[model samples]
Target: MCPHFSTGWGNDAMTSTIVFDPLLPWWLIALLALVTACGIALALVRGLSGWPLRALAGAVILAALTGPVYQQEDRKPLTDIVLLLEDESASQRLAERGETTASAAETLAARIEARDNTELRRITVPDGTDNAGTEAMTALSEALAEEPRGRIAGAILLSDGRIHDMDRAPDMPAPLHLLHTGRSDDWDRRLRIDNAPAFAILGEEVSMTLTITDEGAAPEGVRDVPLDISIDGDEPQRFNVPLGREIELPLSLPHGGRNVLQFTTPYVDGELTDRNNTALVQINGVRDRLSVLLVSGEPHAGGRTWRNLLKSDSSVDLVHFTILRPPEKQDGVPVRELSLIAFPTRELFLEKIDDFDLIIFDRYKRRGILPSIYLENVRNYVEKGGAVLIAAGPDFASADSLYRTPIEPIVPARPTARVIEERYRPKVSELGQRHPVTAGLEQEFDGEWGRWMRQIEVEQTAGDMVMTGKDDRPLLVLDRVGEGRIALLASDHAWLWNRGYEGGGPQLELLRRLAHWMMKEPELEEEALWAEATGQRMRIIRRSLSGDIGDVTITSPSGETFERSLEEVSPGRFETQFGGPEIGLYRLENGDQSAVIGLGPAAPVEFEQTIASAAPLAPMLEQSGGGALALEDGMPRIRDVRPGRPAAGRGWIGLTPRGAFETASVTQTALLPAWAVLLLISALVVGGWLREGRR
Candidate 1:
């Protein structure tokens, strides 16, 4: 309980505030009053005739103890605060709504300022961050919190009423009214992507969910709508689909990387805006986990190089087998001890060779462990869209070299039977500087690669020789064999770089790039076009081995084409950033190569519901006794209304003016003088004593 208290709660413009200054503590004063009342009740209950007089004298004494005062305030009345919110979000800026909002805000400000004892606060709410759309309710709540609640008479909002955060609307201290900004007949057709996968495997059907909604008094009998669907900016395919129903569209990506899929409808006459008629969806195409077969012939130092590289990648499924002892090796140990299980050469190279994406032959040579027919099947595997990498040791230059076998057809280089045993730094050839696989490698390490101990001499017969070893001999050669690709490394001493013997070069990076190039990763292609986007900004990149790269042609989803030139930042990479891109799919092409990427989500949250809607604000307005009025009808007049009464009528809205004021003066005076109270109390007590004595 508090030690002190005041009785000064009731006050108004007409009535002087009643206050008290008691001589004792308020709790003690209350106790004294309670005891006197109890004593009076007891006398009355006992049928005493003098009880009434005694009670009167006690009341007089108590009244004088409480020092009552008249608090007549020289009130300086405060002006009523009115919050006017202007919604300039993306949805509000559509059509004539923006202009209407501007005009209404000006007129409202003038009318409010013209009124006596009224103040107006205009708040402009912008579009929410990250496409949260119109958050007018959030702004209103903040504005309400900044002002005194009693002083806030009303809140006015000018918008199309397309608020997205009504759930966060605050409890109103006064009426909240929204003056609608758009025409009554405003209608729009929007395409919505309800569900889209962020990533999907290439060459697989992606189930894309969507909807076509006609909002705000759409034309009657429009049961179905015609949509133009395009993938990667290809020629659109027209199809009629049912309206107002969730659609399941099946789409497939042609290549790995980002694929732009666009869905659009014709903009017919009478629609409010055409921006919502189209939508864009970008899905990243992913390559399925690669199956790589690594065959290591006999235990060697560099056998685990390819195995470790392949195993490190989560996307690569590696099947590795190293020959510990050939059949001719006669160690005094059981055959079962020498092998975990019998080698399944037929199962790998013959039966399921097509399942593997890449095959690595590390220091492999024919030892009659398997017939020459098995090696021929390996050649057939390459011709049937498979990749093979040959990391040659001394065995590649021997009599049993793969160049003498059926695999010679795909070998880009033939061994010269001379293993140069001198340390030398390998170098990228002039052609390698332009190829995507090795283009920027020299610049990464400043071309400071560790020296290798030995390299097999090779004569390049076909394809490109991208690297050279001792005395400019071909160290790495790459070529395409029918539907597959092959890479031959003349030296097995790349392990030296991985060992950091002379400050390890980019062995892991080079090998990873090489493996991806062999497996046909889109980013490693020599001739390609692609782009990366951050909002409406994009960096269009063109990679080409040829120096003469032409201008890149950019095609918007709306069918308008623009050309932008490229600047070469590296040997093969050409790129430039383009800004102010509209929200949709974009097609980039440079005659020889082409790519497609979407800049933003197909349907912005603002355009998702283009038609103005007051439904979102209904709960807030209902609780505050406010009503919605369309701008098509006309602006409503502001009126004063008593608190708790309905604040909206036919053509006007009401604001409650709380007569808030500050007290400037107080006059404390006794209701009766202390001498008069004493005299009255003594007479009443004497009379009561005389009456009791006579009875």
Candidate 2:
């Protein structure tokens, strides 16, 4: 091996020195002054003076080239001992790994701190966000930069042996030692979803891939685990999941809505923990086809409203059931004695109740023609995930209104027989402004909207009053009973608004939303709870008919509680967002109102289970010739293991002559004095001038 050498004069001790004096180089200055004087004299006499000018210029250059520089002197050398410390991150926080690290750290710190001629510095690491493990390599690089390379003795790392930023690790000034924190028994079981999509079309089947792995400390055995999956708030399906393998599960959504699919694995007896057992995913289902059943009591101007609304939708399958005339109505009729055939209430309401997506009752009254049993069947249809809409005219407020029938039990409002005939423009209530149904529709009409000639005086009960007519009375009512939805448009004259009676309103949009909400689309829900997240920051929003909401109790991924009251912005919607602590599945619960949302992956702190093992970091750590040693092996006492030599071995390589420089003071000495520099420079200048003078 080549011995270290200093980049300076070898074997030479003393060099000549010249004292600082302006007169030492004054001869050159005087020569230049005399040359210039002669040049000026010759120029004034109009003779050849170029020779004197050149001489003067040469002298000036000579003086500047001979400036002073101090020479090296005898001095004491400093043997700097660089302390390269590697920190243990969350990965190092493995179950028994941390304890191993603590013992190794104390031993190494004591050994280095007790050294007499050395100093010890530490690079500590806190927790990292996301899944990035401890940046021990990066921290070491920065610490190395701030310290002197010549003083670096070696580097000591106390970690779970897991480092993510190996590319940023700096070339060590000395040997690097990795005292990993972990035991041979260190192991973990993690739940991982190998694949998932952002959105799934409604009524369509989607597949998700999942995997379960047994990490370090995991027992070497095959076991069956319970994995539960749920869509929306429905009953969960459980499976006897196998460990250390990949599985594919097929999921089918029943409706067009936002399904929050949760995948959970029951905690095992010997498992590290259950922090990673649950995961939440939000998927939006697409609605491409709509089946609408339009029932018309009598053919009127409002009959066109129902037809126009349903016809506007190309995907809608409209089955219109218009009772043109009751079976009893006969005006001089012939043999049949009936103007119209009997209505198919049985087949429509019972036989194929699920075929139609939404059923509309337009100005239908309690006409004795349809039996109460048929109406009761309709009520059951509404409860079984079916949509219903009611467009009431004056007949709705009368004794024959459906509100007076068995259907009233599911109706959101109680209709008053009093008919409001005054023409006035209908407007969205405060709640409607933020409501998905009427939110952006108001901006469509800049001027005064046309008016509706007649309105029903209805008292809203369990529904949302999105639109108001005649002094903010509920002109529209929407409610949800069981798993289905209902929308009530009190005024049949809503079509009159489209006729430009006063100015023409957003009649088309209002009716369109009314129909869509009845279909049970998520974005159209009157009461909703959802969240949007970027990194650890989250913005939570809640939509409800309640004017004021209580504290929104938030359950963090680590099972921590964060509560805050939501601000009521509209008549129905309340909202708030928070910068959460860590990443994972977060739950929002207000009283009995509870919702689950995902922030990041699992418990952010132990996402990777920081344990000082060489498995994950072998490739990079081996490049530095640094071998990972388990702290459970009883820290192989820190030794000055020469570079390129085996860093760790059987017996502890304890630092020699411990605390050798404990009381040693550190002081920096100047290599040369100002006077010595000036003197040395003068001698060189005089010597060069004398040699040139001889030439």
Candidate 3:
């Protein structure tokens, strides 16, 4: 049984409290106090008994001037909120971390809910795209912003501890504890490309710095790890590298355009994942200088056109030679007066032929200038990875035509001893529209092309005819001999188009593409497959001379394949786009052609440090009077902790008691009523007066 005390008004009790409201000005109160003090002093000096009565009257007047009331509140208790941040980022999905995180979250939620006056705010942090890795802290800050700060007793984070948004972490009011998820024995070996140039000069050595590191509890005395490197999916070259040390590698790109260099390390047992074990770096190859050899049997109208085309390019190093006089023709002019320099046939055709990227035989004919042995060398050069372009003239139909030489085996066409001199419009053939070198040339010229006045009749023996003139004769023929490429233009009147004859054409563009195609430029390859990435989307492209290209198969970073049919955007170009579901390497294949491209960083920041540890969030936890506990050991018990105390222990984590509440209603009552106060003051005055009278 309980006893209660209350005023004798009714069964209901009223609690009395005191509050104040001054009714008089400070100056008036001060004046009253001064007068009372003076009267008291005078009475004491005069030995008068009535001074006490005067003081009592002054006290009653002051008491009536000040208003007093009592205030009461009806408050409802609020539960303490504990923020739980569950990380579902990519790094957290490694090994058995996902399971561990799920388990820990469930246990924590149950424990928090079982406690009295406690609530759990579970917020899930996911992975970020555009190379932005785990942003767990950002999610935590957002959750904190949505809830009342006073009600937030504490925060518990379960993650792999790889957070990218540490700078965005909020200044928490309560303890922030990190329950790191991962095993102690979880280890990983990764290949790191420290420094690489985005563009490297072709045929020149470019230095790349790389480091191989072992994280977590790697085996002791581990050294000389085998590192494999490959360029453009070629066979990998293996090398021994010391672990955890940076090494410099000098590489030379084989050709121009994008070069994919893949660096990988052999997987070791007990490693976390092989995702970071291999890395990809794309370095574009650029030509420092293109060396071109131009051999002209005699000066002609198109000879200067070729010179101008090669000369206009700043990257080309042109070496031009014209055979003015043959050995049979010995004019009576003096040697010094004839010319200052003689053509070095041995240097251009035999000795240093491989030094040039392209060799053009413009209207070349056999006039006893180059020996049979030297011509044989040119043939051997073409068969062994060399490029030759032939611009034919009337001489191509003559007995001295190059078709009569040993190099004719590689020529795509044979000249029929007939030269037609009739105005005829040059048109791209059906195959030309499907060949990368001349695919869109007709469209670029608006389907209108200039006419050539002369064309040497030729019979196509092999190769593809991309352009035709004079009754559908082979005007331009392309062929591949062994590892080399050969292109032949049977007419020299192409220069007429350069002079804007009949509204001109894409003469410059045509010649540029032709030259680059013979040099095996990746962009001009007839059969090629490649991909480009923008954000999380990838544009896959396929180029083929064949009509039936079929579908393209895409393999994701996780080894999942998706097939998509190609859409023909142009003659030879087939393309489609894929919205990447995840970031990493993507492999694209169409029939026999295959290409590998990476959508994000070679080694994403999420997997950069795969061995999970609490070092990243340690500072934040320490600042909030909390500690890090691993889930591998076991789930910790949730406990209530006081403010400014340690919030984590060996087997338990703590949440602060907020003692928060909400006021439902309030009541205000006067401490003393007007009549009651008046009576008390009157009694005090009367008693003082009676005492004075007695005195």
Candidate 4:
């Protein structure tokens, strides 16, 4: 945009324009000329024959007063620029599309360079950040701004028509040609997650809607395809789902925590790629507010330990009842002095017993309070998937111990009718170190566990002995009834740890782990296999109650299997980290335990549409006077075409050659010398006088 001159496109450029610099004001010069003309006209009209020579002399004088100049410029021509945009995003790498694109680009570049005055600006479109897919049009718009619009003879793109940003396409000054890569018959099947919830109840059925879409043309006779579904990292459950339809699948999670669910369709032989054939959804399993029923025979120091732990958790609803007045303790103190809510025994044990997630009994000795029928109902509750925990004291060893009643069948251990009262530190059994509830507890305290002055002597009848008190007697036991789980803490002195007695052990940590284990949390499972993915890296974990396990078998999304030995970093835990090479689903197996995790995005935008089509760029090509020609036929021939003519044909594409340049030099010369104009005017005047005198 130079103010000196405007440009004109050609092989070489030069320009000229008129500029003025007058010796005298234009108005005064015009007046003098008008007066001279009138004088000569009067002489001619009055019959004087000398007016013609006088008029000629006057014209020469007027011309000398007005100075005139000529101007010219020199310029150098510039070469034309043609954009060659190549999309290298993930979609272009599928099948042989990448090879075809790369070869075609090389051929086109050679041909364009061979042309007389045309050069190529190669722009590569890589994967967009945050799954934006192929940004071919975005790159094109940026390249257009870098160079002169007129100089850009044309723009050529090489891609698989999976561009994500079509709305960002720029206005083209010249034609645009698309050397479309990928075959027309290229087909693929992608699993799409229509709707998925981020959090689901553990026991409730998690419903997810999904669709099986076939891009391009799928193989014929493929009505029902096999879909594999997995929860956490367990073995996949295969089922037949119809193609191209929305399917609602019901899922069940065994534990409350983060759960990874993968739904994948097996790759057919002729499908484009397996990358899009699978989808991964991570739904965290959350427990609905836990309803805990705490029934204490008499309020003790250890009762608040259980109450505080359950109350501190925002997701727990606690219903505690302490029997202040037993059936035999009829004291003279009136009921008006006591502060308590009505204890609805029948409602708790019969009417709505199943509503509670867990029932806790602390130091209860029957005392004829709950009739035998109510105790039988409590036993039946434990056999029907209900969880019950008993914290025993001296009452457990008395004649009326709960083990001597109908509830004894569900108790993991029975009292020996003896109570040991001595200062002794509690210790974890050998099997406890491997069990989920007590695992790593000893390590946490590291021989600094507090001592308990009291422990109820009990002999294991069933279930596992996880903790021991005085002289290796059972301190804690866990067992599974018909369809439920029950735990017995032999001593009620656990509150000693809470009071920091003798440098308190991990009282809160131990209680938290025990509660979660009783509620069946996945992370507290004794035997499990799972993998976690962050970006492209994956961490595979194996937890077992036994010694070292074998190597885990890793199966990639493409069904390629390999083995890697896990490192033991803990007592019963083994794991290893891997940098995934591709973006897709990964399955890991160690013996019977298997897990599935997604390494990258479930379905990348690049693979969402794999087939190459010209429909996306149809309007752009038509507006730019270009055509979409497939590279499958052959590499298009490069040729020079007029700016407005059709730039692409069956086997050829075109570039417009704009001879653009810049001004290199300029010069100006005056029309005539001042001295020469003066001499000519005087001679003309003298000749007119001499001629008039002779006449």
Candidate 5:
């Protein structure tokens, strides 16, 4: 089928003449013999002595030099082939290169199969993990080694120009050709969050920096983006967030809790994809420790409630002062006979007020035990980041209540005179459900909650009514005044709740949470955003008052921006997870909130995906004058490409014909046998002797 082919004579039909002349080849044998005879004749004409010996030596030298041999048979020359190496790396999988490579491989394979003299060999390359590039050249070297170098003609390569293993290229038997794939106009954009901290102190100002970038196909002059930030699910604050710059935002945590900061940029309406929009971070909030002064007005059934809750945790140091007797209303017995210890008001509240984090007034009245100046000092304590709790009995609505004292300026509400005794089950309000202290309580209740025996109705004008008593009056209220916090549990029946006298509630846990919250524990605060990352994926959570969270903005390490939304599964918890393409610290902002989370290991996925092809073999195929075609492409037709001709064409490369000596049958003739030499010597000697005698 190949046009370059020629029919060769059969072995039996082809017979060439053999010559046994070492001085010349068969073509020059006649001339060499003539030259030798001329030499011998010239010696005789010159009348030279030993002319026969001279002629004999000349003839022997000529025979050895000619190296004459007899030809046996000749064989047909084999066709040379060229192989094409194709690239199969991860980068090749991008765009339509994979499809192109596959098509080329098939086309070349068919062409090789159709040609009688050509064969197709497929060498597929797998991508090495961890960003190692394609090994196409290595594959070509291997293919070259397996086949005979003399038979190879040329090679072709099908690839994207991303070959990584160039160091081990082999000596090519043919020329190499490259066919590259890819379009020039590809582009992309990504959201990036540059740096965020993992821990920040509660109630302290912490700064976070954010950045955004455009990748691949960025439009020119995109600027002045608006970004929203939120902390612990507060109201979103918008800023004229500049593009291509790191913005420093100063943030202060309001309470001690797990502070989840979510940062986000608005999703660009017309973008390729929203996958890279928002970022999230979760930081734990902690206070140095809360020191409380427990002032016992008089020992009562509920007195232990305050002590038990505060003392249960080792972090809180309680300075308990019990007033056994008043200076005016003392019993006739001596002070030493009294069971209770004398109140240390001057030592606890007066001298050491600064050392206390919070002070509890348990049913204390204007008993004239302390001066009004001391009460004023307590109010100053509340103004300077201090906390206070009031456990009121019926005396709270009376004329002797602390509201009548100097501390009332910092008091949120004045207790009304009305007090109602009624049984009620403790329940969390809508706000309380989201508050960190109450969110997970549903699991503990198991549908049956504990009941309180009695609650006092109080009229509240300010603060949140977290718990209700009979007729829905606020039984427990929390309020902020100045720089301090105050809470009031109006009834003393909380101890009954813990005792389970009315079918126990989460009294211990609730009381514990309330006390800690009052003390400003970070996890007990409401409204937060946080994230945890495992490798390239991240799990983001937003805890907020609003059950539904808007889209979150994420910034990646490469300065790309993306937006994501939070789905609320519980009352106040909103959450989602995303796969991060790169490994770095990412910043997430939801509205005015922001957090930082990590993505990917410092080292990413171990192996990169390699496209399956063998383009690196192209050079070897070309050098061998063989066409390296993809098996996926049509296999090239192998024809006799002339040995000294260009390697590529419709057919295979030519194989060179060997010299005649390659097929010649070799024979060796010794100068003479030992017996012939001895006889020659004897004849010479006998002739010499006879001649001498005649002389």
Candidate 6:
């Protein structure tokens, strides 16, 4: 017997296929089955001959009623996709890696494009912003998601193997190969600050832990390395430390507020970069406790004001003394009956003088109670880094004023034995508007302040006259004596502001700033240059008492210098913002003052390991049966392979063959015509009847 199958026929060409579509409903087919079954049953019951032949004839008639069709389609084949990812991050730009990556990428792309039925996808990964390091894996994941999964044959990467987002790696359908860059002998030395306190008590030692480590192919037998340390742009101190070890150093803050401490390791030959070899840590210094000595010559209305102000501050430890009676005015009462205790002048003035941070003399006059010897000690104390504030009154103009005592040498002004008693408003001098202590005081009172009742007449001697009253005489004077500071307020009526006489002024604030400035707070320094950094931007601030502030010179970590002129933001403050191009230490200089600050991390993550290696991406390559090849050896050959097979070898990379395609058009046709089916049914009936007749 011979069997036949039909092919489809379309408008363009002739073809063959086999399909079926029933012409009659299911009830008619069921009725035909019942009639055929009855006839076959009758023939079987009568033992009739040719029973199967009759049934065959009936089946042929039923088949011609049902219709069948054949379908055909036209398909267009799609090319396979190959991804080439190139890394151009900061780490990849080091040494010869940039050249290596460029060359390798060009060659690999050319080779992939030369192959048959292959499409090349080129993606370049750049350095992430805000110090995010390398993000090669993120780029790869995005490329994979955009392309057809079935058509993606393989992926190739050219990088330094410093990927930061390995956890975001995709579940790749094809092999992922890496071509490493950079030399194997590359090495680097870095300084790491393991632990540093953001704040420390001033004049007290704070501990910091640091480690110096050598990475990559470092020289053998290397142990001790010279390290240099500096504070606030001062001279650097050199010390020898063992390599690859943690060391603890105790640091002392010089004054309050941001104190910059710089640590550096000497550069050696064959290192990647010296950027990580230096580090800067800024510590905010806070005073543990401020001790102030308040001495009142005789009790007066304004004496209690000084006590209240000093006692209000939680950080101040106040020691106050009042002389109720002068030695010349001794009473008849016995010494034992006296309620007052000895002032202990010798102990406070000579022995423990250095313990106090500030001393205030309110309405004081040279009396016999404190001898001239003890008064000389006060003058010596001021010259040796002590602070003294003299609140003068009518007594300052008298013959026994402190100007006649042993402390006369350090007095900023001399009284002329004339006291002006009149209502006059205090005013900030033009120079005072530039001085830090009095710079912004007028702004607080809208350029107007309360009145003072009296001011001592004095000569314009030595020191800066920050305030004036009554014929423009110096009302407030500030001067530096040796290493100490002295401020003399000629009037004792500042207490009037505390009493809110005629719309009170910023007397409290003024007095507070004056006290702090006298104690040498860094924020109140007359001549200063400093820079504050946020991210990669820095704000350079210059504070000066002089009206003429020269241009500030900035030095970058790589020894590049830039000069920028400061704009006067206020009376004495000049400031400007700079966007630093790179991360590392920066130096600022204005006249004789200088400052140093660090930007970004001490050791950026990109420079932590400079040498190129396959360790970071080794797991991904192993899981996908891919291999890593060093570009320094040579560019590998590209080849095509079958899926589920090894995609890489010693000197070659492979891409899988994806047989992807698309259908452009389709067509359908009936398998047989109506006349042909009728003819076939007639032939079958005649043949079956002939055989039955012969029997």
Top-lDDT candidate index = 3
Ranking by lDDT: 3, 6, 1, 4, 2, 5
The best-first sequence of candidates by TM-score reads: 3, 6, 1, 4, 2, 5
- Looking at model 4, residue 686 earns an lDDT score of 81
lDDT of 1 by residue, 427-507 (tens): 888888978777778776654789999999999999888888888889989888888899999999999887887876878
Model 6 alpha-carbon drift over 4 Å, by segment: 1-74, 142-150, 333-342, 445-448, 622-625, 659-695
Which lDDT tens digits does candidate 2 get at residues 1-695?
Answer: 11222232433322223322233466766776667667657655764324344444444444443443333233234444645454556555546555666666677778777765577887786555566667777788788888766567666677766666777778764556676666666555677775577677766778888877777667665677788887654578888888877888788766665567778887767665566666667776777678888888867897987798788879888888777766555565542323356557678777887888888888887756567887787788888878888988888988778888878889999986799989777888877776778876768777778777889999998877878999889988778888788888888887776677666777777777777777766667766776777777787778775666688888886789988878876556677878887656678877556666767653354454533466655654455455556666665766665556655566454222221112223222323445655566556556545644565
Error of 2 at 358 (Å): 1.4
- Which run of 10 residues does model 5 get worst, by summed lDDT? 602-611
lDDT score for residue 165 of model 2: 74
Instruction: Single out the weakest 10-residue window by summed lDDT for candidate 6.
Output: 1-10
All candidates' lDDT scores? 0.83, 0.69, 0.85, 0.83, 0.64, 0.84
Task: Give the per-residue lDDT of model 3 (tens digit) for 46-106.
Answer: 8877776667777767766666657655556788999999999888888899988998899
TM-score of each: 0.80, 0.69, 0.85, 0.73, 0.49, 0.83
lDDT of 4 by residue, 1-695 (tens): 12446455665566764444568999988999999999998988876667777888788777766766555677777789999998888878888888988898898889888887778899999999767888888899889888988688999999877678889989999999888886768788888986688889878997878888887876777788899988765778999999888989777777677777888888888888888777888888888888899888777888888888889999999998777765555776554334465568788888888888888889988776677888888889889888888999898899988888889888999888888989888888988887878888877775588899999999899988889988998999988898788999999899999898999888788777877777767798778888877888888888987786999998876688888999987777888988777777788889888777877876777777778888889999999998888889888888889878888888998888887777788767666577887788778778878877887
TM-score of 6: 0.83
Candidate 1: where are CA atoms >4 Å away?
1-15, 25-27, 37-57, 182-184, 293-355, 364-386, 398-416, 424-451, 459-468, 471-473, 479-484, 495-509, 526-529, 539-578, 587-594, 664-695
Point out where model 5 deviates above 4 Å: 1-290, 328-347, 350-354, 440-443, 447-453, 547-549, 602-695
Task: Report the C-alpha displacement of residue 548, candidate 5, in angstroms.
Answer: 6.1
Residue-pair clashes per candidate? 1, 28, 0, 2, 132, 10
TM match of model 4 to true structure: 0.73
Q: Which tens-of-lDDT digit does each residue in 1-695 have in candidate 6?
A: 11324333342332234556668986797788789889888987876676776776677666655556665556567899999999999888877888989989999888889998899999999987778888998999999889999999999999988888898888888889999996778898888886798999988899998899998889999899999998876889999999899899988888788888888998888888787788878889989888999989878889999999889999999999677666566667553333466567789988998899999999998766668888888898999999999999999999889789988888899999999999999888998988888888878776457788999998867889989998788999999999999999999999998888888788888998899898888788777778888988999999988878889999887899999999999888999998888887788989998888878865677876667788889999988778898888899998888888888999998888787867666576766677877777677667766867887
